[model samples]
Target: MNAPDASDDPTPLALPRVPRLRVACAMQSDTGCVRQHNEDAVGCMIPRDDDPLALAGALAVVADGMGGHAAGEVASHIALRSMLHVYYASAGPPPQALAAALVAANDAICERAGADPACKGMGTTCSVVAIVDDRAYVAHVGDSRIYLLRGTAFRQLTQDDSVVARMVRDGLLTEAEARRHPERHVLVRVLGTKEFRPAVAPRGMPLQHGDLLVLCTDGITDQIDDATLASVVRSHAPVDACTKLVELAREAGGADNATVAICSLQAEPLAAQPDPSIRTTRETRAH
Candidate 1:
């Protein structure tokens, strides 16, 4: 809840770029400071910008599923697959597609749970960001989060939809107090609920060179403090940043499944710009 300060960002480091807009992501799930099986799941796709048949760049998500009897894993996978399908099949801005995909995924999870008695009450927290035409549209539910780093500053975009979060919003609990609350783990919204209506609105933002967007589950944020998290991201490569983040979470006694997806949009190469001959595929006007 503290505004990012110099102490927040990890010491700056050198990170190279790939030919196209490089989105280097890495994820690790530890049974964690303690646990029998990992319940977290992550998915990524870098769709072709020109190919009409490609599903790349349409959607990338990180889901932290929760349920008893191994139902968490099932929910995560189902959400990912269904979201990807809807995202690609539908057309429009990345935000609209992302919202549609999330709603569809939520329906799919609900349907599956309805059919299987054992998987009853299964649910998953989904946080997704879709990139199109050098912009990102974010949709999230539950405590999973989306963060951004621009220049030397860091900021978190999505608000958590959890019991503790609701308390904070209502002014009944301070952020620091919520961190230590016994019921902090309680979630308010997640996929698979019969009354599931996720916060699937598309929140579009301009993409800047060297901008970094991170979508992660509660596991990572719950353990590592925001200042430390931002520092690690600023100090290492995307892959290494993710590794370090997981390590930090473990160091802080990771009590849940930890996952992180690092996406950095470097400046497009001069030669990579679209040609005038092809029609521009504008998703939305610049903000």
Candidate 2:
């Protein structure tokens, strides 16, 4: 005779919780055959299972340093270290946090360069990819790049901030001509510069199971063509993909410091325990 209580409903308790997305990542960096010192830096920040902040889902970056001597190495190391530190310490969404992190890194590098006469003109190209849930956010400066590979198709996600890239975009030069251009390696925008402005992706890229994300310095791109790069990625596992890519670049004369980070996304399945109290019946079907 009494009205049923809404709080007593059992339907809400029967609903299942959503599973978290899982990502497998691998990174490889080499000084290459020509460079006396490795000026490239690669790193990733994978959140622990019990992390409280949760904002730092997964972040990966690759930085290619310039300005000869040990200055290049120091610039790149500073870029990566500062970016990671600021990213984890800051609050808000992944995209905003990543952008702020890059800015902080640029400022840190600039301050360091200005403080030391030997590193005055030092700069570095940086490309970062941050994934949260089923989406990926990107932040980049200079010629380093972030690429996405899904199934049989591959695409570059970030535009190069290099003179040759700008020329090609303006129709002043063809892709082939740009590749062979004398100033192809000359960067128009890079970190550690007074006028540095990071290019952040307007929106996160929707990720699907089996999606592959590649973050690398121009060293890899300089040695490997897009088609060949795609083939090598598709043919190898995540770890092997990184190793093979670096190896391929080195085999191609290794003109610069080669560095690569590969991340593969997969959907995690929820775990359900069997209830011994539930009675079940098995019935065989006829063929």
Candidate 3:
């Protein structure tokens, strides 16, 4: 036998790298039974290949407007549009970008409210989610909410900036009592105000495969409880879940416009390969 050669030594092959998670989103909005016109707005923007400032992920936003007639709709629309635009247009990390976008949105809404008499004093509740890589950054104002469903457990990621919520936090009222309180709809912090500040998630939440993010105006939560909401999301696909939730809200006597956006993170699919066992044949025959 030949002597063993150093160059022929066996080496282990490196393991394949795992692919990044891709997000699937679904959204719906409805004018509830009581509301004559929908004052809620929902928007989402996924990064494109050609965009240099892209976060390599997606952004979802929900805004609930608080003014009568078309004013409320305009405020919510402006806030949603401005926030999404600023987030994609600015170049920075997710948290900073989200903050800047919210501030810019607030200024834009305020300016519009000041300029137009019909929209004066118009304001809206906003909840935004910036999903980048394996993390999610959340920012919000007023009563709209963001919830996270990881595995079987569900958690509220944002707090309501309403009087009832404040009372509950201060121990003056129980959660149930606050929910049924007469002033539950009074918001303390809302966009379009001269002085407004948003509460941003201090640290990003680590996202996992099968993680479900629920963004919605209070209209949905007002009708369906958290447990029921989570159950619906887990039982159906993203689009179907949104549709079911909105329908449920309407069935529960939706007193306000309902809007919901669902986003699910999933592992990228493996590439497909051609099957050698199957062969194709082309024949030319005289007619």
| Candidate number of the best TM-score | 2
Model 3 over residues 1-287: C-alpha lDDT tens digits? 99977678765344455546787789999999998899999998877646764553699999999888989999999999988888887787777778888899899988988889998889999999988877899989989999999889999998899999999999999988987899999999999888777567667888888899999999999999999999999999999999999999999998889999999998765354223344568798999
Model 1 regions lying over 4 Å from their true place: 1-22, 53-58, 277-287
In angstroms, what RMSD does candidate 2 have relative to the true structure?
Answer: 8.1
lDDT of 1 by residue, 1-287 (tens): 97779766776543443334545455555657876767888887776656783543646788888888688888988888987788888876666777778889989888888899877888998888887656678888888899999878999988988898899999999999999999998988899887776565545677777889988888899898888899999999888998888888888888888889888787668577655444456588787
Residue-pair clashes per prediction, in order, are 3, 0, 0
Global Cα lDDT for candidate 1: 0.80
lDDT of 2 by residue, 37-106 (tens): 9999999988876796555788898999888799989989998998888888888778778888888988
What is candidate 2's CA lDDT for residue 158?
90
Pairs clashing within candidate 1: 10-231, 47-56, 47-57
List ranges where model 3 is wrong by over 4 Å: 1-16, 269-287
TM-score, each model?
A: 0.84, 0.89, 0.87
Compared with the true structure, all predictions reach lDDT values of: 0.80, 0.87, 0.88
Error of 3 at 256 (Å): 0.6
